[model samples]
Target: MAILDYANPTRFLRLTQIVLPWLTAACLAAFAVGLYMTFFVSPEDYQQGQTVKIMYIHVPAAWLCMMTYSIMAISSLGTLVWKHPLADVSAKAAAPIGAAFTLIALITGSLWGRPMWGTYWEWDARMTSVLVLLIMYLGLIALWRTMEDPIRAGKAAAVLTLVGAINLPIIKFSVEWWNTLHQPASVMRMDGPTIDTSMLVPLFVMAGAATLLFFVLHLQAMRNEILRRRVRAMRLKAAAGSRAARMAPPSSPLSSPMSGTPGAAE
Candidate 1:
C-alpha cells in the first residue's frame, strides 16, 4: 500500500521537486571535498606511485556501475511482480546512467592499466565480465526504446534484466574465480581493507558523491518520462476526438426544407 501510494506520478513528482535541490547540493559538495582530498591529501602509493590516484575515479565508477544495475534489477522486480507504477520508469532511468558509469570504469581502468601493465587492456576475466555488464545495460536500453508501449517494454526489459543479473556476482568475484591481471578485492575483503585510511576516506567520499549523482539523474529522468507519457496521452485523446467527429454523419439540407414545407409538398 505504501509503495503504491508513492508510485503515484503526482506524488513522486512532488517528492522529487522537494528533494532534488538538496540532493544536488549534497552531490556537488561531496564531489568538491572528495576531489580535494583525492588529489591533495592522499599520499602516493609505494609501488604504484602517482598512478594510484586513478583508483579514486575508477573504483567509484566501477562500484556505481554495479550499484546502478542492482537498482534496476530490483526495480524490474517491482515492475513485473508488484506492478508498481514508477518501477518501469526507475529501471529505464537507471540504464543510461549505469551504462555511462560502466564506460567511465572501462576507460579509467584502461588508462590506469596502460602505465602499470604496459598495455591498455587484457582479456582477463574481470575485464571481460564487466564488458558483458556494459553490454547488458545497452541491450536493456535498446529494448526499452524499441517497444512502443511502456508496459510491454517494461515487462520485456524486466525479464532481460533479471536474467542478466547473473553477471553481478561474476563481476564481483572474477579475479578470485579466474587468473587475471585485476587485483583481488582489497576494500571489501574479510581482511579489512589493505588501503590506507587517508586514501580510503577520499575513495568513500567520491563513492558517495557518485551514488548521489546517480539518484539525482535518475529522478530527473523519471520526471521526464512521466511528462512524456502525459503528452502522449493528451495527443491520443485529441486524435481520437478528431476521428469521432470525422465519422459522424452530417445533417442533410433537404431534411430541413422538407420539415418546413411538409404540408405544401404533400
Candidate 2:
C-alpha cells in the first residue's frame, strides 16, 4: 500500500524536486570534507608508503560498486514482484553509476597494485570476480536498451540481476578463498576492523560521501527517466490520433450543395 502510494509519477517528481537541492548540497559538502580528510588527515602506510593513499578513493569506490548493485537487485525484486512503478526506473538509473564506480575501483586498484605487486594486474580471484561484476552491469544495461517496452525490459533485467547476484559473495571472499595476490579484508573481518582509527576515520567519511553521491545521482536519473516515459507516451498518443484521422472517411462536398438540399444528388 505504501509502495503504491509513491507509484504516481507526478508525486514522485514533486518529491524529488523538493529533496534534490538538499541532496545536492549534502553531496557536495560531504565530498569536500571526505576529500580533505582523505588526502590531508590520513597518514602514509608503513609498508606501502604513499601508495596507501589510493585506498581512500579505491576502497570507497569498491564499496559503492557493490552497494549500487545491491540497490538494483532490491529494486529489481520490486519490479518483478510488486510491479512498483518507480522500481524499474530506480534499477535502470543505477546501472551507469554502478558501472562508473566499478571502473574507478578497477583503475585505482591497478594504480595501487603496481608498486605493491610489481605489476598493474594479476589474474587474482578478487580482481577477476570484480571484473565479472562489471560485465554483469554492462550486460544489464544492454538488456534494458535492446527491449522497446519498459515493462518487458524491466522483467528481463530483474531476472538477470537476481541470477547474477551470486557473484557478490564471490567478489567479497575471493581473497580468503584462494591463494590470491589480493590482500584479505582488513576492515570487515571477524576480528573487527584492523585498520587504525587514524585511517578508519577518513575511510568512513569517504565511504559516506560516495554513498550520498550515489543517491543524488540515482534520484536525478530516475526523475529524467520518468520524464522520458511521459514524452514517449505523449508521442504515441499523438501518432495514434493522426493515424485515426487519416483512416476516417472524408466528408462529401455534395452533402452541402450550394443550390438546394432537395436536388443535391442531381
Candidate 3:
C-alpha cells in the first residue's frame, strides 16, 4: 500500500527528501569503512599481491553496473505499462549513474588485467557483452532526451533496455560459456565461495558500500530530474501564456500608441 501510495509526486517528493539526508550520511560512513577494510584489512592475493586490492573497487562496480541496468529496465517497463510517474523518474535517474559505474568497472578491470594478464584488454565474450551493456545505457539516455513526449520516450527506452538485458547473462556466464581470458566465478559457486575469509570480508564490505552509494546517487539524481521536469513544464506553460496573450484580440481605450487625443484629433 505504501509503495503504491508513493506514486503520487508530492508524496514521493516529501518521502525522498526526508530519507535522503540520512541515506547520504549512511553512504558516506559505509564508504569510509569499506575503504579502510579494503586497503588495510584485506590480505594480498598470493599471485597478484597488492594489485588484487583493485578487485575491491572493480568487482563491486561491475556488479552495480549490471544491477543498475536491471533496475532501469524494470522501472522503464513499469513506466510504460502502468504509466507510473516515479518509474520514469527512476529509470531516467539510473542511466548516467549506471553508465559511470560501467566505465569505472572497465577502466579498473583493464588496470588490473594489465598487471595480471599482461594486457589491458581482451576480446572475450564477457568483455564484449559488458561493452554492449554500456552502449545500451548510452542509447537509453539518448532516446529519452531525443523525444519530447515523455510517454513515447519511456516506451522506446524500455524496449531498448529489455532487449539489451539479453547481454547480462552473457556477461555473467561468459567465462564458463566460452573459452575466455576472463576467469570463472569465485564467490558464487555450487560448492560455495572459494575466496578465503580474510579477503572475502573486505570484498563483501566494499560491495555493500557500493550498493549503498548507488542508492544514494539514484535518489539525488531522481530529485534533480524531477526538478528539471518541473522547470521545463513551467517554461512551456509561461511560453504558452505569452503566445496566448499576443494572439488575444485587443481591448484597449486607444487603438494604437500614436492615436491622437481630443485636441490633436480636432
Best by lDDT: 1
Query: Residue 85: error of model 2 in Å?
Result: 0.8
Count: clashes, candidate 2: 0
lDDT of each: 0.83, 0.82, 0.78
Worst 10 residues of 2 by lDDT: 183-192
lDDT digits (tens) for residues 97-150 of candidate 3 = 999999999899888878877788865555566777788788888998899976
- Model 2 C-alpha lDDT per residue in residues 1-266, reported as the tens digit of each score: 43454458789899999999999899899889988987888898777787878988888898899999999999998988887888999999999999999999999988877888778986666566678789999999999999998778989999999888866676558644663344554221212266778888888888888999999999999999888888887787687656655766434446443443332332
True-structure Cα RMSD, model 2: 8.7
Candidate 1 colliding pairs: none
TM-scores of the candidates in the order shown:
0.84, 0.84, 0.83
Residue 227 lDDT, candidate 3, scale 0-100 = 78
Question: How many steric overlaps does candidate 3 have?
Answer: 0
Worst 10 residues of 3 by lDDT: 183-192
**How does model 1 score by TM-score?**
0.84
1-266: candidate 1 lDDT, tens digit per residue: 53454459989899999999999999999999999998999999887899889999988998899899889999989989998888998998899999999999999988988888778886555566678888888989999999998879999999999988865676658644664344444221212278889889999999999999999999999999988888887787687656655766434334443253322221
Winner of 1 and 2 under lDDT: 1
